[model samples]
Target: MSVEVTDQDAALAYYVDVLGCELRTDVEVFPGGRWVEVVPPGSTVGIALVTRESGIPVALRLGTSDADEAHARLTSAGTAPHQAVIREAYAPPMFAFDDPDGNALVYLEDAPG
Candidate 1:
């Protein structure tokens, strides 16, 4: 997955420190641009932090084994979600939150099919 962030350094810190992601790569791809990638533990997916204006808000759909546990963890880590956990019709329990850059993201209890 890819996300457009204003500052790569800050994004790296947030994803690594706050979100508990492992820094996979941090290299300069161009003169002033960088190619930073981070991946969560026990997961193969990588999130690329791109430093460019895409003019669109990022909305990442993530999954956890338990919504309540994940919510508690994130909350204790100082990430106040936009909404508390809720069960929608025909959907798994989920909650929405924003990154330091105000990029919207959701964490659902069930994994994707």
Candidate 2:
């Protein structure tokens, strides 16, 4: 997933420091532009932080082993989740939160497989 940010360095810090994601890639693609990617530990999916003049922020659903724990951690870190975890029968337990750049993201409890 790609997220647009006004500042790549700050975005990288948030993803790495706040979210606990590891830096996967950071290289200048062209003058005044960079291609930065970060991924959750042990996850293959990577989130790219891009800078552009126009683009809508992304809403991403991420899988977590425990929604409640993840929510607590993020809350304590000052990410302010949007609401309490939803435990509806029709959906997995989940909660939404926004990144520093206002990119919406959801964390859903992963079902046993």
Using TM-score as the measure, the top candidate is 2
Q: Compared with the true structure, what per-residue lDDT tens digits does model 2 show for residues 5-112?
A: 988899999999999999998976446657688998789888989877433235586999999999999999999998999896645798889999987888979987
1-113 in candidate 1: lDDT tens per residue? 57889888899999999999999988764456566889988898878787665322246868798999999999999999977897855457988888889878878687656
Stretches of candidate 2 above 4 Å error? 1-58
Location of the lowest summed lDDT over 10 successive residues in candidate 2: 52-61
Candidate 2 overall lDDT versus native: 0.83
Candidate 1 regions with alpha-carbon error over 4 angstroms? 1-58, 111-113
Give the per-residue Cα lDDT of candidate 1 at 32.
66
Clashing pairs in 1: none
**TM per model?**
0.46, 0.50
